[model samples]
Structures are given as structure tokens and as C-alpha cells.
Target: MKSSRSITTILLVTLFLAFFLGSASAQEPVELQWLLIKFWPEYDDPSLLVIIDGELATPGSELRIPLPADAELNAVATAESSGRLLVNDWREETTADGKRILVFSPQFPVFRVEYYTPLAINGDQRIVDFELPAGYLSTNEANIEALLPPSSKDIELDPPADEQGPTQDEVHLFQRTVGEVKDQAIRQKITYVNASGALTVPETASSSGALLQPTPPPAEETQDKTATGITGNPWILLLGVAALLLIVGGAVGLWLTRETDENEALPAASPAPKIKRKKRSASTTIRASQSNLDRYCRNCGREFGPDDRYCRYCGAKRQTVP
Candidate 1:
């Protein structure tokens, strides 16, 4: 009875395991659309930028996307639906011919990842040729679209001109349909002239276009002077005006000084008014003589007492002067 019970349990577990495995394998792969924009610098090789937009019918714990062999893995980022960047749990491996493979296992249902790959310049024209990898486990309907930089002119695609999509940003669009995910050898090749001949490097390899450094106007043409004296530093003009103002002010001050000297003569100093003194009469000039002075001692020229016969100061005999 125990042996029979054990056999029944084994059959039940096997059936459950089989059912789970079948359901997981049957899940449909996500639909993927890859938009790649190749930005060409005036000089140096062009850079390839990629944007991936897709929908997953079966949300899985991890996701994987194939990148170009020469991709810069450090520049990889996963973005949310609202365009906010989410933490990426990803790693990369170098492949043959300096190409790289980026693997990301994002936890989101819908996400976007962007990165760049350096392109090679072959012959005179810049070229981008690559094979798309099939990383999806299950079958998926996928499409690939490529945009050349706006400055790119004389662009040519691998799939004849008729097979190309509409022109956008002055460059023809190249698209390929990879219906149902399989190890199909999907390929893309593009050729174009680097519009500026790579004379100047691009500041940004943006999808819209590369932001180029403006070419300076020709030296000979730019040398022409304008009617207004507004060339060069404006501070120089200000300094000239200030100097003119100072010169005019000095002239005005000198003129004012000259006019003041000429119009108003300094008063000639009059000999301080002669002080008038009245002539004195004889009676006013004469003063009454003292009687003691009249009776002065002759030997010492000292005044004597009223009845003393000798001067007390010199002890000489007193003599009268008439």
C-alpha cells in the first residue's frame, strides 16, 4: 500500500512540473523597435547612437538587448516610461572586432535603453555596417530604423533607394523588417559624406543632430570696418569719451580763470590812509616844571629837599640854577 502511494505522488509532481515548464516556454517574446541615429563629426569618425523602444507581452524578471560591437558600454542607461532614469543592473562583454555586447536585466515592464558606438571611416566616405543580434528567447516581431545626422548629405543605404523610408532631417531613412525573432542574419549598411569634412568636432552627438562649432567668418571679409566707431572693446570708447570730457573741462576751467582775471582786476592796494596828526601849540607842548627840579643838587644832578642845603643821595653841596 505504501509503495502504491509513493508512485501516485511521483506522477502528480511530474505532471505539475511539466505543465509549468510548458507555460513558461510558450510565453511570447516582446515586440522591439530599434531607432539608431548616426552622428558624424566634421572630422574624426562618426558616432552611432541607439534608442530602443519595446513592449513585453510577458513580463520577465530579466531582459537582454544586443548592442553594436563597438558600443560604449559605460554610456548605457535604462529609462522609465516617463523618461526618468532608473538604476541599471547591467554588465558587458567584449566581442570580436572591438565590438561589445551589453546585457541588462531590468525589473520594469516597459523600459528604454540608450548607448553609443563609434563608427569607422572607410575610404573617403564614412560607413556604418553591422548585423543585428537576436537576443530574445522567444519569437518577436521586430523592426529596425536608422536616421543619419541632418548635416549628412549624399547618403546611401544598402537596400536600394526605393526600399528606403521617407527623408527626415535632410537624410534618407533606412529601415529593415525583422519579422519574428530568429537567428536571422539581419544587416544594415549606410554610407554618407561627413558634411563638414570633419574640420570641427561636434559638441554633442544628439539624435536630432550634432551641435557643431560655428565656423568663424573669413578674416578678410570680417575685417571691414563699420560706420560707427563701435568696434573692439566698448571700454575703449568709454575711456576716449572720458578723456574728451576731461580735456573740455580743463579748457572751460582755464577760460573761466582768464575771464575772471581780465574782467575783475584785483584792487590796487591804497597806501593805508595817511594818519592825520594835528600840530601842537607851544602852550600844549610846554609842561610846568617842578620846583624840586629847579632846586636840584648840581654835583650829582639829584633833586634836593625844600630846606636842605646838601643832597642826601650824593652828600654834595646844593647849587641853584636860574
Candidate 2:
């Protein structure tokens, strides 16, 4: 009887341990491929954007993300295959240790979360203390980036960033990369001095209630257009118009010159023919006037024949005159 009781107790304990281990394994946190964290303070309050890319063992499984206690979630979404984010339904919960967490079931593997919290601002100086949530796990690569305010200067970072540079929009950026980030909370500190309270993000973007959406980088064609002043510069348009007018004027002038040259190379034209008039015969004119002549010569009173060479009376010779 004693042996049977001991064997039954052993069997019960083993079954209990097996069940507990199975449940724990099934509930293990999913490992992430990478986590990107961005700190932006261009609003009334500072904000953070977190993007997680990972594959779940089971699709449509529940995911729990830890955030700052004072964080107010702005947007929660999952990325589609087309790179479009579809907003997801999420709920906020608190753990026994007073840590705030967001719970959601993402339909896709990649997800995004955005939240805003207050910053530590003292006069002209601003400070940001950001850390990844302990609930998340990343493989080996993690990235943190902070966007400095417009017109800000005297930037400093704790455990200095790997890269610091200005973006095309003239916005300053500080970025850090860490390896083997798994389950550990990656923390960063950024400090900057800004006398002017100007905002880097456009007012329309913030007022439209979608400040958390990732702004796509400016297209290359758009930059080209801007550089050529095709969209905004009046001088460019004016110059283009002037150039076109010059080209048209030159073409017309060339055509006219070519026509003039062709005309000059042609042969001269011939003159018109002259009109003719009728002529009278001399014999007819003489016969018509013969009847009107005198019958005797004035010098010797001699008779003249029709074809007289000289008068014959002067020399005692016959003579005919007309």
C-alpha cells in the first residue's frame, strides 16, 4: 500500500511539472528581427515612434508591448504587404509591477506604435531620456534615432551616437545602434539648446491628428523639379519663355534670309516685243505729185518732160523736165 501511494504521488508531481513547462514554453515571448525607436519633440510634448519587425510562431497571436507609464498612445498599426499601415485595435493594461503595457493582436508580422510623453525642459535647454520597453525582444540589431528641434544647437548625447548628421530637410538627427539587444531596455539621452521654440513638423501634419504616420522621403523627381524651379520659381518660367521666343525668332529670320538668297540667285526676265508701222513707196508719192508741177522752167520758159536731166534751150539741146 505504501509503495503504491508513493508511486501515485510521483506520477501526479511529474504530470504537474510537464503541464507547467508546456504552458510556459507556449507563452514564451516572440523574438523580433529588429526594433527602431525614434524620439521627436517637435510638438507641444515630446513623442516616440516604435516599429517592430518580427514573425510570430502563430499568426493572429496576442502581443504585449510595454511603454512608459505616462505614455499616451497616438497610433497602433500593422504593415501590409503593400507597405501601407492598417490601424489595429489595442488596449492598455498595467502589470502587477505597475508597468504600463499595450495589448493587441496584429494580423501581420510588422507593427508600429506611437506615443507621446512630457519632456524635461528647463528654459532654453531640453533633455530626452528614452528607453526600449522590457517586454520587447530584438535579435541582435537595435536602432535609436532622435530628431532635434528646428534652429536648435549645442547638441549632446550620452554614450554618443554612432552617427550625427543633418537630413535633406535640414533637420538634425542623432542615431545609435546596439547589438544583442534581446529583452534588455536600451536607453539613450539627448540634450540640446534652443532659444527659439520653432517646430520642425508642419502644423497641418500635427493638427490633422495623424502626427505619428511615417512621412515618406521626398522623391528624387520632386527634388529635380525643385532644383529646376519648375514648380515654384517664377524666374525659371520667365527664362524658359524668353528662350522659346528667341528660338522661334531665329527660325523665322533664317527662313526669310533663305528666301531672299533664293530670289537673288534667279535669272533676269526678258523685255516685251516692239510694235511695227506701215511704210509708203517713193514712186507712188512722186506720181501723185507730178500733175501739180509747173509746165515750163522759170529760167528759159522751156517745156519739161517727165524725166528731164537738164534744160536743152540753154545749150541748143532737147530737154524734158517734170
Candidate 3:
């Protein structure tokens, strides 16, 4: 009986160990490629932009990131390869330890989170105490960049930056890089004195407008359709005018051809009347000769006898003197 009890206890322990190992293997943390944190005071209030670029072992999985309890979320988005930002849906949750976290299921691997937090300001000095919590993620690399105000002087950073220089935009920058960030939170403290209290960007340009929001991707199809609509109307109008002109020309041509055919199909006009000449009869000619008495002989210049039918001197026929 003692041997059987020992065997049973060993079997139970083995089973418990197998279950624990399986659970541990299933809850593996998501791996991040890089994390970029930027602190800028260009807006009406100081802001933080956190860009998380990572690949998910399982696509469409839930992701959670921890933030300060007092932080107010301004925007959350997923970035495309084309650098266009698409808005993402998220919700806020409170942890058991009284900390706040952002909860969302990301369909894509890369996402961005931005928020506004309180900046400690006293007189002409400003203070920023920023923290990045490692709730359930790990990263191979991390970068932090902070922009100082335009007229800031005597700038200071705790855990001093690795480099200090002016950025391409001519703004003073404090930069730091970390390797193999895992299972630990990152903290930074920056202080500066700005007697003028000027911001990195103008206040009017960043005040509760489009500057505060992420720019949406352009709608190429809609714009193409609008351009087609604008340009297509003139062509349609021109075609209509051309068709009308052709119709008018065809009608006129048909009318002119019909008129020519009608004139050709009619009979020719009648010719004018011609005058005829009358011929004299032989009896009329003999009466006119008998009435005339004065006569001359033919072939001789002599007087003719009465009722002579021939010329006596030359024996030639006498011509009538009619």
C-alpha cells in the first residue's frame, strides 16, 4: 500500500508540471522591432508620440500598452507602407495595480499611439517626467528624442543623453538609444528654463485644428471621377453641336438636289413662229407685161415693133419688159 500511494503522488505531480509548462509556452510575449518615443511641446499642451513597430506572431491578436493614469489619448493609428496613417479603434482599461492601459486588436503589425500629459511648469521653468511601461511586450531597440522650446536655456536631462545637437529642423534635440529592452519600464526626466515661453511651433497653427489630427489618406478614385465629370461635359456639348450642323447641311443639300431634278424633268419651251415668202404665178406676170408698152429689143439697142415676139435684127427672143 505504501508503494502504490507513492506512485499515485508522482503521477499527479507529473501531470501538474506538464500543464504549467504548456501555459507558459502559450503566453509568449509579442516581440517588437523598435519603439520610438518623442516629446514635443509644439501643441497647446505638451504631447507624447509613441510609435510601436512590431510583428505579431499571430495576426489579429489583442495588444495592450500601458500609459500613465492621467494621460489623455489624442490619437491611435496604424501606418501603411506608403506612410499614410489610418485611424484605429481602441478602448481604455484599468489594471489591478491602478494603472491605465490601451487595449486594441491590431489587424496590422505596425501602429502609432499619441497622447497629451501634464507638464510641470513653475515660473519660467518647465519639467517633464515621462515613463514607458512594459506591460506585456519586448523590443530589440528603443529610441527617445525630446525637443526643447524655442527660447529655452539651461536645458537638463536626467540619465544624460547620449548625444545633444540641432535637428534638421534647427530645433535643439536630446537623443538616446537603448538595446535589448525587455520586461522593464523606461523613464526620463527633462527640465528647462524658458523665459520667453515660446513653443517649437506657432500656437495658432497647432490649436485644435487639422494640425491636431492625423491626415487621412487621399481618395484617388473620387478625385478622378470629379475630373472626368468636369472634362466630359464639354466634349458632350461639342458632339451635340457637330451632329446638329451635319443634320442642317444634309437637309439643305437634299432640298437643292430636288429643285434641280424638278427643273430638268419639265418639257422644253416652244420655239417662236417663222415668216413664209409667197411665189408669183405666170398669168400675173403676163398681164403686167401686156400693160407696159415701152419695150427694148434684146441683144440690140433698137426699138421693138408692136406685139413682136422676137428681135428681128438678130433673130433672138425678145425679153418681156415687166
Best model per TM-score: 2
- Model 3 residue 151 CA deviation (Å) reads 1.3
TM-score of 2: 0.54
Better of 1 and 2 by lDDT: 2
lDDT of 3 by residue, 50-159 (tens): 33445454657677777777776666767666766667766655533456556667647667777667678888888888777654777777778787766778889886
Clashing pairs in 3: none
Clashing residue pairs in candidate 1 (N, C-alpha, C atoms within 3 angstroms): 42-198, 43-198, 69-99, 69-100
lDDT of 1 by residue, 1-322 (tens): 4434544555555555555554554323234433222332332235655555554455554554566645543233445667554545555433323334444565555545555567666656778676665434334555667655545667776753334644643554566665566555456677887645443234643432331222222234333221122332333444555555555555655666666666567776688888889977766555324444557776778877777777789988765534
The ten-residue window of minimal lDDT in model 2 covers: 207-216
Report residue 125 deviation for candidate 3 (angstroms). Answer: 2.0
Give candidate 3's error at residue 123 in angstroms: 2.6
Q: Which stretches of candidate 1 lie over 4 Å from their true place?
A: 1-45, 66-69, 79-87, 93-100, 135-139, 160-172, 198-201, 205-322
* Model 2 Cα lDDT, one tens digit per residue, 73-118: 6677787877777777665554435565566788787777777677
RMSD (Å) of each candidate, 1 decimal:
35.6, 34.9, 34.3
Question: How many Å off is the CA of 200 in candidate 3?
Answer: 1.3
TM-score, cand. 1: 0.42
